[model samples]
Target chain A: MLRYLVPLIVFLGVAGFLLKGLELNPREVPSPFIDKPAPSFSLPKLHEPEAQFASKDMLGQVWLLNVWASWCVACRSEHPLLVQLSRANIVPVYGLNYKDEPDDARNWLRELGDAYVSSLIDYEGKVGIDYGVYGVPETFVIDKQGIIRHKVIGPVTPSALDNCVLPLVRKLQQATAQTVVKRTEVEGCV
Target chain B: MRSLTVGIVLLCLLVFVPLAFAKEAEYMVADPEMEKTVNEISAELRCLVCQNQTIADSNAPLAVDLKNQVRDMVESGQSQSDIIDYMVERYGDFVRYRPPMNASTMLLWVGPFLLLLIGVVVLVVNLRKRTAVIKNDEDLSVEENERLQRLLAAESSPQVAKRGNSSSQKAGEEKS
Candidate 1:
């Protein structure tokens, strides 16, 4: 009886792991950048080619760094939601225009509507690699300290924005603000 | 002269045809030594976009870009482990074709041996139980021995004797 039961128990254990594996999305390679400082980059702005944008410039703000390409179909799906988020002024959304032609990227924004504080042109995708962007339409939520708090691979769906992105942004903003206030209080007491 | 011309054309074909067929490495850097290092590293790294293919084998844009990144790093004189560490740092351990042994992957590395040990134990236990059963079967009870003697004495033919022995064995199995 023990012998018969042991094999059955092992089969169930293997089956449970396989069932869990089936539910997991293979495309979502977990990013190592989470809780790490966001990889810094300085690239020309998409709208104003002469003007440059740097990652360090957004150091004191809770912002979204969205890696997008005009060629990416998934970016189109998330574009409207980003537009809505930008309009609501919840979090400043910055775009990393990855491996796209300047003209085509400009035209795409012109047609679809630009949803970025200022889009940075990463023509060679060097910056994309630095940020460990395996897929386009990946969104990164960075805290005021410039550390990446969360990453949404593929597209930023409405549910993801509501559940994960927004709440985290609000929390980080409040947390960072408290830190700043505490520093000032210490100085005042001194 | 015509034969000479044909020979010359054949010679040219022999030389140039192989050149035409020769495939240049798509992501080759200027340095051959560096390119070899780049390839070795690329083969070790997984292509994030196409999960099955290594960055070395894949022609996907990301793969090509990664290959280029490897080449650049190699050119910068960074050690192999350093480059691997850099990739693992950004992409996590998933980027490595050969997963490093870690707390999470300890089971992955050790699992096959563990399974094999379990299989050996189970086999040994089952075999021991079977041997124990056979040992128990060898000792016939007094009533069974009396019945066996009666059957053997009654059976005159060798075939009948064989059948009686088999039937007694079957009875023993049922008892077990």
Candidate 2:
């Protein structure tokens, strides 16, 4: 019994170690960057001098935004959408340059077509905390009323624009126009 | 006001210089109903690449895709079970953070019992071999017994044995 116990103990120890090594639990958490007003952020451009911008400045317009790092492979996949976004003039595309070196971000922008209007260099990831950005390539759609209208946490789909964004932006724009008209009519009555 | 305008223009230059167009936060918005479902399903699925992480915690692209797929399915009127079944069909049992007990997964469920059974059988075999040895030892012949006695006598029959023998003889005379 004692002799068998040694082997059994060893087998149990080995099995425990193997189980620890084979522990395979992977998770994909959705970015908490959804539906929340874009975290207010102010950062300088990675390349241009003496220029800083924040979310407060973009309050009056509807925009599509992406948080990207130069090192993110998935961000590269969506670069073409940014280019088309520029050509389509659908809305301004803002970029949050996440966790990447300034030089690399600039070089990447040059290489992939600088289709973004302004990119905030979040070098130390302070803004990321506010937005709950788990990883790079997260996107948000902010309506003109300073409310987030939609969020796509990964790569963009072409249909997302045609099906979701265009209709939403139209509705928001119509709503804003109607509100202005109602206010003017009230002022005339007074 | 002049300085403010200049400041505004300067800031715009800085911001717009990189983007030919302003890049909006396009994908961060969530539909309330779909968002809840996405969160729920993501919490259940295990990420395959990063062990010890659920799909809700994993930052892997595949995990993100799976979360998106789960969201899509839930939005499309699939029940939680239906969503899980779809995932299991596509990615196999490993996708489930908690796999169900079934005949197909009997090994995962009952592997320790199988090991215990094998261990018991091996232990019994070894114990029987040892018992067989002990039983064989019990069947010593007279010559073998005498040989065993001689070996014991070598150790026991010294001056000490002489004293023990004298004492035994005294006892025998007394008894007589």
Clashing pairs in 1: none
Give one digit per residue, the lDDT tens place, for model 1 in A123-181. 99999999899999899988898888788888888877776677777777888544532
After superposing candidate 1, which stretches have Cα over 4 Å from the reference?
A: A1-11, A177-190, B1-25, B141-176
Residue A171 Cα positional deviation in candidate 1, in Å, after optimal superposition? 1.0
Q: Write the per-residue lDDT of candidate 1 for residues B23-125, one digit (tens) a residue.
A: 6645434778777888899999999999999999998999999988988888889989999999999999999999999999999999999989988998999
Q: What ranges in model 2 sit over 4 Å off? A: A1-35, A177-190, B1-176
RMSD of each: 7.2, 22.3
The alpha-carbon RMSD over the true interface for every model, in angstroms, is 0.5, 11.8
Best by lDDT: 1
lDDT of each: 0.86, 0.71
**Decoy 1 TM-score against native:** 0.83
